[model samples]
Target chain A: MVTIKDVAKAANVSVTVVSKTLNGYSDVNEDTRRKVLKVAEELKYTPNMLAKNLKQKVTKSIALIFSNFERANGKDGVLFQIMSGIYAAAVDFKYEVVIYTRSLSEQQNISYWKFCKDHKIAGAVVTGLKTTDPYFQEIVNSDFPCVVLDTDLASEHTGSVSTDNVGAAKVAVEFLISKNHRKIGMINGHEFAVVSRQRLEGYKAALSEQDIDFDPTIVVNSDYSEESAYELADSYLQEHRDVTAIFFASDLMAIGFMNRCREIGVRIPEDISILGFDDIVLSSYTTPKLSTVRQNFHKLAYQACEQVIHILEKEEKGRHIMMPFKIVDRETIKEL
Target chain B: MVTIKDVAKAANVSVTVVSKTLNGYSDVNEDTRRKVLKVAEELKYTPNMLAKNLKQKVTKSIALIFSNFERANGKDGVLFQIMSGIYAAAVDFKYEVVIYTRSLSEQQNISYWKFCKDHKIAGAVVTGLKTTDPYFQEIVNSDFPCVVLDTDLASEHTGSVSTDNVGAAKVAVEFLISKNHRKIGMINGHEFAVVSRQRLEGYKAALSEQDIDFDPTIVVNSDYSEESAYELADSYLQEHRDVTAIFFASDLMAIGFMNRCREIGVRIPEDISILGFDDIVLSSYTTPKLSTVRQNFHKLAYQACEQVIHILEKEEKGRHIMMPFKIVDRETIKEL
Candidate 1:
């Protein structure tokens, strides 16, 4: 129960001086160090012993580094929920989490490596994987253990964690087919992410299974924003007059598609059925709601944290793990 | 440079055994502990000093506890951004963050508090204050060092951080007045928060400054969300047909105000100019954009961290610090 303050008061020095002496910050005098240590030893200061042993090795802290977390599109969605789940598990384990916002590019410029080095971060959780991010190589090559979400980061030094993207996407498109829609259009996300590519592949597979020829003219890529997707959905409604249903890569895009359809006198389901991926919180609240692929982000991040800890603690299970996804039926899709 | 894996390997024991032995988990065998310690000493294994100190004292973490982070209205705004600032500061300070979300009423279910205690949290950032919260009294009176964001937190705590709500709101309303608009309306956040009340005062202050009669009928109070604010804004617009411009408390509500105006066939600026507070990122992207008050949240959180750390470490200085806000002119406001 001996505190740094007690040591500071006893040694007649600032807490900063006491902290520097203990942490080997190399800024304090030798006499002060010995006096503090003598008092600390008498108090049975187990700060770096039983409670925090020189023999102790696990700090049980990890960093979840993402970009612009709160400003993520659509006001709410899968990303936040997944983050919540990670938080829940961490609290369960009594582990502390450090949230970092530096992207690979930002990391390169910000001198945050010095910060990371000083903090002794043992591992990290990475999200928002743009394909050509310069930080990926550093992460792959770093000494710390890591759990990557959404990114297809395969390396021996790191543990991969994500939802089954291809399967989720296929189920989304196939559900529209089950609803009896043949001519379908898609509002896709930016091509920089592996999930986007996987979802696109699933889109192709679903159409090929139903003998529906995939048409490039009806597909559009957006910046995963509601307004941009709304504009794209409006353009598609004009350009692809024959398309009966639409599949969006994200729930925000589906909302946009629906909003635009409403603006243009096209009724949801009755005029053009829409389906989306990442069945986030807003999916259930949107008027008429949205039928979409359900990626259990909570389970994904929770399992990712557990897996990364397992790997960091040398459980020696595997290098990669994937969480499951499902289809959530809502009102956005209709029987053609 | 030595890790738990190295110690475990050296002692020919599981890493969990090494962890439990050092953590004093009471489950590790005495013989196993002795062997782990011996090997760890030989390997010179050292756990992170900060993490160890956190374990010995508090959890080296703080929970920024919010009552229903997913507020029922689904309007994301300045609140979440403030949460981000808190998180960023926690990261910089090497403090672990845990977010506890439940309804304000359910907070005293006592489980969240027990979780914090179990995690050994040093303190918490209390947000989303409500009269019905049972846990509020317990936390306010506790020995823990808390930094509160809610303006209505019993006014007993010394380490409180907030924005200059009255000043921010006054600037926004005065801006509308300067533009030659006389008949202006107002939207206020939930009546529960003291911060909202200050803003309401600022609105009336602006009216009083211009010697205009204070019209309580033109003011509407709703939860800080788009959907809920939509109904209230709709009702206000329905009753007050002559109001030329309106000032909303938050940007999300501003978007809702515009959406309701759009529904009623009233155009922004041309029909009824609108001004929103808390110029969030979407304010720039919202259709016609949003003109409102802006709070630099990054700086706000940074200062809050500096304040809290100062209070805890520097023996309680600068008990109350208020950051400034500014008006952001956008497309929604009409020129005289």
Candidate 2:
């Protein structure tokens, strides 16, 4: 309830001074701004966001509209950790993060534009970008600056930061093949996500280099979860009994695959080597610490935040930034 | 950027009519509102929030301001599950959620009024209400409608929703005493959080009823994390060789204690029994499957949302709401 007027009264300055000082308008004197800020703090005065955001044309905030639809349940991998990085960077830049996602209700389909405009956000860090999602496309086309993560959207309008998915996948295959596993299977993510498509190409590319057959029969599409991986692997393994190793698109799916393997009396690494993508934290703790691709999610998320801020500042625009990825060696892989 | 004008043009209505319709004003007829909604959907027109929210005085959004400091690297309980529930509920209400927390630098020292005012939030859900926290007192004094979680700030001015921490703890200890644990160890939370004190008191109350000695030495204060739990349990076990069982204030802390136990080669249930509070998903997955006092976090979060909505509606100003807790019998417990 502490409005701009109260801030001005507390600071012993005009309302215009308080408003200008609070809005990052460089025209205000630093001494006056500091005095206003100090008094505002003591008085517990909250600047009127509605008035300032409208006039200044910046909230110094970012919107992260998570699709909670993707089941990211566990504390694993760099996925959520990467998110922490964005949070860290935002805080470092003195920006607020507004997270608008699905709550408990079935009717809670979010209105992206309204949420953004209502907040008067300077930019956004887009996550859980579903392929062909109309909402994603809308934000991409908007004048508002946005940084898309894990997806390469239309570069002309949006800044994107992604891990080198294809390179990571290729490294995983090279490691597996180096260990003398020729008949490898892959539990893939649904082709809707750009990362999944990139990973698949990497898998195929690795196979092609080694003169291995690109067997479609060995590939099964999973819906980015442990259970999905379990189901996909269950059927894939059943169909391709000769395969000695399997690569999963996600850590959860890999965990699921491991769970199913245990249920069906299949020994990991000894009976079949399993590799997971996303090297989440759980991968290291799993019974057979998974060998997998590691996307520097923290780096990716940080760069994403950095890029969005740059775009908001108009120092750069529509940047397609790609960070590096690696394959981490854990206990899951078998020796040749 | 499909604006209000586009929606109005498509719906064959004036901009005022579209605004009125979108804002749920009585001036607009139901037929016109329906037409605007339908055409807006067809064109994917999300209303401009800046124009609408300032005038209507409701964001239909809640800001969840968490304590940025003292969070674990991962495996956070109640808060994590509560978020899951909040997500489910927000979906139902069609309200956007904004996540706000102090930056690491500004965490211990924050200006709550400035944070809230700058955000332009109508209402907020304040989680992790630390007693010493400046924000706690600031929020308690604020006239704005807020829902504080996991605290007993039962007053006419604010709405509070939490599990009966004392009751749940008493039940846990009673269950253990029933199993004949005479010298039980405990790892409690930080002193600032009310649940830590409540649960600790409940532990003593249950012991008092059973005519057991309440040795202060048996209790160790942790920040409610695996590392702290590990340290507490490691030292406590070293000192109290007669301790037959250990009770944890949180599942993550219990998991930490278990890890410590593992390092020391003390077998769970056999060497030292463990009882965890908050039946997180980890409880079911951890080695020996943690026996726990289960606070229905999902329901708790859902109820918090519903309570805030109720308070906002002016239907009732119910201040204190307690969700039920249950004892989950799992592998970590044993008869002493």
Candidate 3:
């Protein structure tokens, strides 16, 4: 097998220069870097990353920690989108990704820091963690470089990435209000999730801005499950028949609501217009094509990976990144 | 940080015994293993995987290579299911998963073997490779331990895992035939894909067995793309009006055909019935829920990972594993 030494000698460069160039360090001049790469390719030199990482005492890899990932299995593609985005960004940065599913970690009784240490992971991008989770506090307090998704928790080492959930929800609700719907009911996800609470704040803000009285009775919470949302919709719709529109915390919840409406002989847009958050794939194929606040999950995850990489490689202090969101109008909403 | 030596000393065992016990080797006696694990846990010993992997000359990690994975991004969650299965299996075996998206490899001009060598990947589970792909032949002939998905290519070091595509396709076509449909057209995926050829053979065998004259003109091919299938459906439907039903090679293609049928004012199962393969998530949500053959994608990937690990750890000869499939009857098919 060809070694880096052979490539360095063939390229008339020092071993350090060859290593730096191959590892994408910017100090190496462009011409020298190209020459070293050409020599390495010609000699078929495959660097042993395990050995390099051992010598450095840190692997050029990031851990993607998704808490309770299996819960989303086939129900929602949001986690998959985030994973793809992380992979794409990791590829761009020439870093490997090691997934640490939090459920597995909990089952093994391994903490996030321990998993990172055992794997020699340089940084991590964590998602699907509720603020009340034990791991959430541990991650916030740990000095390990990481980017937390969906919650604004930044420190010297920890970064954050999420769509402006509050603003996005406010915009979604204002869109329904703009359609002359005065009585709008909101179905939210669990309050334990920071995003859910933020979205609720946005919902209330939108009503306040429009001079519409916010009714606490009309706002209900579900555990982000379709069945839970379906059950809530069944009861909420009966008691809140005067409401002209409803805003769902997630597309999956909206789908459940739609299913319940179908079963209960309620017509969408004719009976009540519905708007949802998270423009998941199923939203487009629904009966009336759900109008939603589209959170760019891919972009959010991509930026999280980028942020963690930056914190690791550049020794930069972590910062919060708010990605853009859009209001997607489909057939579900009506110009009441 | 507590090291293996500290744990071994505390447990009154040799370092090698402690290492073997902690690594889950059965050679260590149960009492020693239990004592070593307890000591290690009590001491908060986190093994440095980088150094361990380097010393062993191979990482306890499997590479999951997905060729052109981005093509399926959000359209179908089959790849995600496969990934989830792989991860679940990897965690069960205490092995780490490193994803290698082939698109990045192609752009960087890295061969599969080179990647394995660089990362010291113990084994790999490869999917979505065409028979004619340059990497496919390389993987088939390579000495590295691996398991290929959806293709039968077994050597001393290479295993194969896939659903029984031919048998499943035969059953699907037979179901349509049993419904008293005499004239059936077929829409296949790209000819280069092995599954497409297998399914086509099954379609022909079903026809031959039932004494239905095989008309080659009625069979058409698309590039396993929704738009391509949609365009093909337009002309195919116009040309073959006598066909009472059509068999699609994949659910995605079936969806495309369904979309075109809706546009041309052709009612499914009334004007023409449809049978699809690969029960993707969208199939259940289509206008008149798709009836199709369901390949257990998650199980396929899980078995593939298990096979690769078995080949690497136990020095087992690679074998072809055929998983079962099911015919999911929904609303797409109608009795003649």
Candidate 3: the clashing residue pairs are: none
Candidate 2 segments exceeding 4 Å error: A1-47, A56-59, A69-83, A102-120, A136-144, A211-213, A232-241, B1-48, B52-59, B69-72, B87-94, B103-110, B178-182, B315-318
Give DockQ: model 2: 0.37
lDDT of 3 at B168: 86
State each candidate's chain A TM-score.
0.81, 0.84, 0.90
**Chain A only, candidate 1, TM-score:** 0.81
Model 3 regions lying over 4 Å from their true place: A4-42, A104-108, B5-39, B104-108
Model 1 chain B, poorest ten-residue lDDT window?
B69-78
- For model 1, give the RMSD to the true fold: 12.4
Pick the TM-score winner. 3
Q: CA RMSD for every model?
A: 12.4, 4.5, 3.2
lDDT of 2 at A158: 73
lDDT of 3 by residue, A1-336 (tens): 677889888999899999999888999999999999989878988787777777878778899887654786765789889988998899999998988777744835877677678778889999888777768878887889999999999899999999999999998899999999999999999978898999999999999999999999999888777788888777788898899999999989998888889889999989999999999888877777889989888889999999999999998998899989999999999887
True contacts kept of 3: 0.73
Cα lDDT tens digits for candidate 3, B1-336:
568899889989899998898778889888878888889879999787777876878778899987654776767788889988998899889898988877644835877788688778899998888777768878898889999999988899999998888898888889999999999998998888988998999899899999999999888988777778888888898889999999999888888888889889999978999998889888877778899999988889999999999999999989999999999989989999
Q: Is candidate 2 or candidate 3 better by TM-score?
A: 3
Candidate 3 whole-model C-alpha lDDT, 0 to 1: 0.87
